[model samples]
Target: MKTAVLITIGDEILSGNTVDTNSNFIATQLKEIGIKVLSIFTIPDEESAIIATLKKAFGMADVVFTTGGLGPTKDDITKKAYADFFEDEMVFSDEVYEHLRTYLEKRNRLWILDHNRDQAMVLSKAKIFLNFYGTAPCMILEKNGVYCFSLPGVPYEVKPLVKDQIIPFLKEKLALDSIVTRIVSVVDIPESILSETIEEWELALPKHISLSYLPIGSRVKLRLTGTGKSRTILEKELDSEIQKLIPLIGENIIATHEDKIEKILGELLIGKKLTISVAESCTGGELAHLITSVAGSSAYFLGGIVTYATQKKIDILNVNPRTVEDFTVVSEQVATEMATGCQSLFKTDIAVSTTGVAGPGRGEDGKDVGTVFYTVRIEGGEVTSKLFLPHLERLDFMNFVSQKILQDIVSLLIKKNKSPQLY
Candidate 1:
């Protein structure tokens, strides 16, 4: 496989002022076209630092891709650094000047300063790719049979250049093949236990296929990637491996496709033609937000109630006052009542509730922080409640509980036909 290195230049990234997303975007694109990214470097915009990083990166791989510091500002010296590193000087390009002039004129940016026009300066002996999206042009330099591409750091500029220009150039230059990837998401199973259970099946996989586990919230994503001369063969091999894995871990797998928990849950509800509602306390409307985030969610998601106050839960959802007085707002009994109340309020087929104390400190009834009780109720059937104590931060705790609630809902739906109590 062809190999490449990515370098992102910005002091903001190091100081945490800005997150470096350019490297990830470039790396993923490279991988899809059969270029393996060896390493990624993040550095300041200092010319000497950029030169040093570029030299080291070019030494390690066939291609070096750098983003950032290609603007008109004083801090943008990536172009100068490239000139110095290549033992060349900057040369003004009339073609680039006209391109910049037309770009600025069309945008009604008539108050163009000299610095803005300086974007036409080019590195001598380098190939230039015009940036359709921004002022800074993409640059390509070749030395000792290695190629280095310098792209604008702005994500919008980088995306079009990579997709329209860089990808095509690299494809013809490297003669790359497509890389196919498939995802199978499993939930309610710890990674360690899942690995142990599927060790034998995993070991029997073909050499070209690789499996990676990525954990999100309470779910584990099994990413299967296969690269070969033909995309058809790679997909077939990946699908065959997935089928083999099904018998081993299919029961634990909530989604066989690459989608978030909410989308997967939404699909399940839509497939079964079931309508749902939610009653939330500590998680607020987070559960509702997740459900409604999916497109066409109105088809299955009826509505939700954020009964943050215990009195609201009692008065609005008609939870028995005695129940909260005896079991507390964060108790399983309260969660169950909330779910049942939601079913009645929305008149839906299914309902879920989240009652928790997602806090930096303890909540009422002596419940510790991150203490959450979840309930999923089938309108005419049984209710399942689970207590999850993840001890996460306030927002994280809310997000995790929302995901867990959806997970529990999917699990119950999967077993509703098998279990007499669930039906």
Candidate 2:
């Protein structure tokens, strides 16, 4: 496989003030075209650091990509570093200047062209790729048969440069193989046992195919990746292997395609023609957010309510005040009532509810941190579950509970016919 290295140059990233999302995005784009990212380095804006990292990156991989330190300001010294690294001198490019002037004039900001004119300066040996989104141009240089692409730090600019320009250039220049992958999401099973159950099938896999077990919350995703010269053949090979492995754990498999639980839930709801809503407490609308994160969720996601206070739960959801007074707010009884009330209020086919204590401290009712009770009411039947995860922090607890709730919803829908209670 062709290998590449990614270098992120920014003191803000090293200081944790700015997140390095460019490396991840660029690496993913490269992977889709069959380039394997070997290593990633995050360094400061210092010219010495840039030159040193470039040397290391070029030595490590066939291609090197750098993001950041391309602005007009003095701290943006990547251009100077590139000149020194390539033993070249800086030269003004009228082509780049005209592009910049036209770009700014179109935005009615041509008066500031002189102030940003330094952006038109380029290394004499470098090839310039115009930046339609921003002032800084993408520069490419070669050293000892290795290519390095320098890009601006802004994500918006980096995205188009990598996706629209650099990726096509690399594809045309290199002879690359095709890589295809499929994700099988499994639930209600432990990773070790699941692996052992499929060990026979896993060991019989072809050399070009690989499997990875990714455990998130309460679900395990089996990623089957195949690489070859032909994408069609690889996909068929992967599907064949999955069919062989299905009988081993078919009951545990929730989805054979989608990687995310929310997407899996969305597909099931849409396929079954079901409408759903949520009543969130300690989970605090996280369930709704996850559901709506999918495109076209409006087809099944009717609405949501976040009844955080005890009074709102009682007044709005019509939770019996006596139930909370007797069992506290974070109980299974309250969760069931909330789901029933939400289903009635929204008139959706399915209503989900969460009542939990996600906190650095104990809940108001003295319930320990990370105590959650969630209910999924479908039609006239309901299922309520409880989880106590004191090991997780507040945010993590909330997220885990929300993910588990969605996963359970998917599971219930899949087994709705088998289970008479859900009908």
Candidate 3:
């Protein structure tokens, strides 16, 4: 397989002011084209650092991709680094200059073209891929039979350049194999135990097939990847291997295809023709947000309410004020009442509720931070659970609780019927 290294160039990324989303996007695109990403490097925009990283990347992989540090203010540093590394000189490109002029003119910002004129400079020995979405163009240079592609930092520009130009170029130039993958999401089991249980099946796998255990929240996702020349053969091989894995851990598996819990729940709800609603407190509207994030979620998602305050919960979801007074708003009793009220209010087949203290400070009722009580109500039957996760921060606490709630709901739906519709 063709291997590549992704280098993210920016101080903002290193300082956590900006995330390095480009590496992940580029890596995924490369993986689809049968190129395996070997390493990812995030470094500041220094010419010495860029050149050093380029040398290391060229030594390690057949292809190298770098994103960021291509803006008008910083292009000189990156360009000089590329030229220094590739034994070339910076040369002005009339074609790139005209393209930039057109791009700015169309946007009616041609007045600043002189200030942005440096964006037209390119390595004398490099091939230029015109950037349609931005001023900075993608530069591709080759050294000792290895290829390096330097792309703009902006995600929108990076996406189109990789999709329309770079990916197609690599596909046409290389004899790439097909990579197929399948994910089995397992719940109610620890990762260590699950790994031990599937040890035999994992060991007996084919040479081209590989397995990875990815633990997300309370679920263990067994990602089985197959790589070969033929896509059809790889897919069939993956299916056959998954079928062999069913007997050992079939009962614990919530999904065999979908990766995200929200998407998995969405599929289950659509299959069962069920409508769902949520009443959230400490989790804010994250539970509702996750539900609606999936496409066509409106088919099954009725509505949601975020009753953060105790009185709001009592007023909107009709949680009994006496129950809140007795249980202090973050108890299982209040969670169950919220779920029931949400079910009645939305008139949906399923209702989910979360009442927790997600904070750096304690709740109004003095409940400790990360103390969550959630209930998943289905057709009048309900399951209430509690979790005390004092270690998690506010946002993480919300997200983790929301994920667990969705997973629990999916599990309940699956277990409620003898034969659940998973598709």
Candidate 4:
């Protein structure tokens, strides 16, 4: 199959003021549809450069994608570039102008002028794509079996337009085969160990199934993509292979999709109409903040505590100072107590807590940095302390600990869901 070329138009990109994220993003999306991105080019908002690149891209690739220069700003020059290439007059469309007017009117700044009018111009024969997020209408020009697409440069605008509209159209037009993808999330485990253990299984994968690892924050995601005529056969092979490789580190699997642990917890709590609370130490209020970041959180989140200082842990969460002294600050006992205390304080069905060393340096007890501990307490589920990394700087440790805690909470929720009440 022929490949697609992604062209990013911007003076800012050449100057390095803004990264060319659209190219990478488009490449990923294209790959999902079994389309290959042959080359990516970024140029200043100059007409000659853009025209030259477009001509080359149209010849070299099956389709050409241009983003970033279709905005209302003066720096955006894609409008004239499209007008010049199509050999057509540029006229403002009432439909696009209404959209642009509404865009500025919502923000209360609708002023009809050349700049705004220019942003609304489209080729008479071009396919118009509405922008759900921005005013720059995407134009698709087709000629002699070549496709050229232009979109707003901004990530927020370009991403949705391309994802929701452009990709689907391309898929249908190309008669591309359906893509089957399998994803798995693993937490409380490093990518290195998982990779090392899964080496053999990975090698056994068929040529159609390609594996890629995307490690974001503290979690590692394994995504397997397979392109073929038989999706069922591929999915079975993928699921069986995933299961076979999983037993080596089954305890660390978070969920199959890209959802974070906190997100998984939110879904569980909301589905069951359960509520949760958190207590924190070295991880800060990040655990609570993570839970609240989701929509409809007020329905499931009772509350939480920061308790950065030991006194607050003792006074607010009722953490026994003796336990803190006996096991030191970053101990399993303290983590358990914190979880239980928050569960009681919030009076919710579930609660999670963290007490650990997130450190740029060693702790007061000379313990190595990143000595983190997590505890999860559900009404009848386990109250267990799981230790993760033992050495990382403060920021890394905080991020790692929060991820571990979230994973623990999710595991407990899953376990609780499986087991019926003994009462």
Candidate 5:
């Protein structure tokens, strides 16, 4: 496989003001054509930093990709840095200047700043790839069989250049193969124990196949990647290897693709022709947000209620006042009541609830910061409740709790579908 290195340049990215999503996007697209990204470097817009990183990237991989610092600003020094590093001079390109002029004219802009005009500067020895999406042109420089591509930092511009130009150019220039990947999502098992249980199966994988473990919250995704001359053969092998995991792990496996818990839950609901609703407290309707994020969720997701205050839980979800008085707000009794109330309110086939103390501080009941309780209720059937201590910050805590609620509901549905007894 051809290897590539990505360099993302910007002070904002280093200072946490901006995210470097370009590298991930580029790497995914390149992987489809059999190129693998070896490393990624994020640095400030200083010329020296850019030069040093470029030198290192060229030395490490056969191809280098850079995004950022291409705009017409004082801090945009990537062009000069590349020229200086290559011991070449910046030459004006009439073709690029005329393209810029036409671009500005179509937008009816009469005034052209010198900085904007200066975007036509090109390294004399580099091959230019004209950017129709932006003023700054994309350029490729080759040294000792290593190719370095410089592209605009703006996401919109980077997207067009990579999809329309960079990828095609590289595919034609190099003999590349097809790379295929499959994801097997597992839950109900801790990552360490899951690894140990599957250690033998993992060791038996084919020579061309590699496995990576990506853990998120209570779930771990086993990603199997394979490279070969034919995508069909690669996919078949990956699928066959994934099938071996089913008998080994059984229902601990949630999906054969990388899907969000809410999405998987939505599919299950749709498949079973069931409708659902939610009642939330500390999670604050985040469960609703996740459910509705799926494209066709409205068919199964009836609605949600956020009852942060105890009185609202009583007045809206009709949780018994005595239940909260006896077991407190973040208790299993209240969670069960909330789920029951949501089922009655939405008249849905299933309902779920979240009552938690997700915080930097304890709740009114003096429960720990990470204390959480959840309940899933099937209409006219069973009600299940559980407790989880995620111990995460506010946002992460909310996200994890929402996923847990969906996962619980899915597990309930799976059990109900497989059991001899309806209840």
Candidate 6:
């Protein structure tokens, strides 16, 4: 088993201007290659500071990953620090200089095109990673039988290089097996109930496996991880564990594979040739956004209505004004009416609606914050509405309400066999 350490090099992270997401990204990729992360450090991108941290990191782990400070900025100092720490000579390389020249010419930053080439040369004898994104390239240097890689700070560049390049390289060189993590997402149940319900299964989990509870808003995901094995073996064990747990949790499972509910809905609607629409209020346009996020959604998503205000709910979605004044917009009567109204208006096969008091504030009848209503009307087939109470702040209340509507649509599709529904 190899131990890994991540060093995030930036002053901005230390100053709290930017979060240090690079280290976690690196660690996650490393874990997939069976490299256990032993420690993580966020340090100033100063020559001495980085060198000292690298020394400590090398002592604790087999592979060290350092990100940030690898751009063509004066404050970016990773390249200098690594060269000094390794006692490696800094020499101009024709290959790196040429790369910088062409890249700058293409981007048309002619002001310092030649100077930028000079800035990009890696430490003499160090293997260079031609960063496809920025001027300061990632570099790798080996010393005393340990491995170190310096990577770019930009997320788009670092993510692919680390996940696709760095981890695969290490796996091959070190003869490491892939580590895999699987997620089972569930909804409509609070975390406390979920914890108590699965306490025994959790305690009985194997030493080779770890079950982590990730509760985000109204949903709870069970993440199962198995490290230090081939991907097939890890997946087999994970599947077995999830199968055993599923029967126990029964109807609580919403979906497998950790994907969002909207994604699940999109697939189902597209596959079944089922068109859909949305009538929304408290959740604003959240349901529509979730559906559209999946490409090819245009096939099934005809259009929808946004009835946030009382007049729009009445005139647009045809929710009767009396319904809002009587049972209120957040009530089940209004929810059902909104779904039916939108389904008819859009002429789609289904309509999902949301109306509620997403409040740290008050509603028509002083409905509490987090009071949400979700409805799914499957085009002249059936209408289902449920009162949803998601844990959320009033200002961000629409987020949870929006998410709940998406979730319900997926749930209906699965039940109808357009998609496979979980418990």
- TM-score against native, each model: 0.87, 0.94, 0.97, 0.74, 0.89, 0.84
Candidate 3 has what TM-score?
Answer: 0.97
Q: Rate the local accuracy (lDDT) of all candidates.
A: 0.86, 0.92, 0.91, 0.79, 0.86, 0.78
Q: List the candidates ranked by lDDT, beginning with the highest.
A: 2, 3, 5, 1, 4, 6
Give candidate 1 misplaced runs (Cα > 4 Å): 93-109, 112-115, 292-298, 309-322, 345-347, 364-366, 382-384, 388-390, 417-423
Per-residue alpha-carbon lDDT of candidate 4 for residues 1-423, written as tens digits (9 for 90 to 100): 547999888888999889888888998898778777889998889999988898888889888999888766777788788778777777769898888878878887765544577777788888899887887888998967988898888899988998999988998889565467767877667789889988888898889888998886567878888877666787787777777866766666757654566677777777778988888888888888878888889999989988888788899888898998898877888888888889889999888888766767676766667666777777856466655566566766677667666766676666555542211
Best by TM-score: 3
lDDT of 6 by residue, 1-423 (tens): 788888888888999999878777787777767888998888987889899999999888889889888666688878888878898877888877778777777898766885576566678877776766667666777887788998877787898777666776787778675678887888778888889988898888788889888876677878888875578887888888888888777577776675676776776677678998888787777778877888888998998767878788888888888888888777888888888888888888888887777765677777776677777878566656565465666546666667666776666666666336453
Q: Which candidate is the best by lDDT?
A: 2
Model 6 lowest lDDT segment of ten: 414-423
Off by over 4 Å in 2: 105-112, 417-423
Report how far off residue 292 is in candidate 4 (Å): 4.6
* Tens-place lDDT digits, model 3, residues 327-421: 78889999999999999999999999999899899988899988999999999698999999999988999999999989998888889889764
What lDDT would candidate 6 get against the real structure? 0.78
Query: Model 1 compared with the native: what TM-score?
Result: 0.87
Q: By the lDDT metric, which is better: model 3 or model 5?
A: 3
Evaluated at residue 128, the lDDT of candidate 2 is: 85
Give the local distance difference test score of model 5.
0.86
Which pairs clash inside model 4? 68-153, 359-394
True lDDT of residue 25, candidate 2 = 98
Query: What would the per-residue lDDT of candidate 1 be over residues 234-353, giving only the tens digit for each residue?
Result: 988887888888888777876666458888788888878999999999988999999999999999999999999889999989899999889888898898888898899999999888
Determine which window of 10 residues in candidate 4 has minimal summed lDDT. 414-423
RMSD of each: 3.6, 2.6, 1.3, 5.1, 3.3, 3.5
lDDT score, candidate 3: 0.91
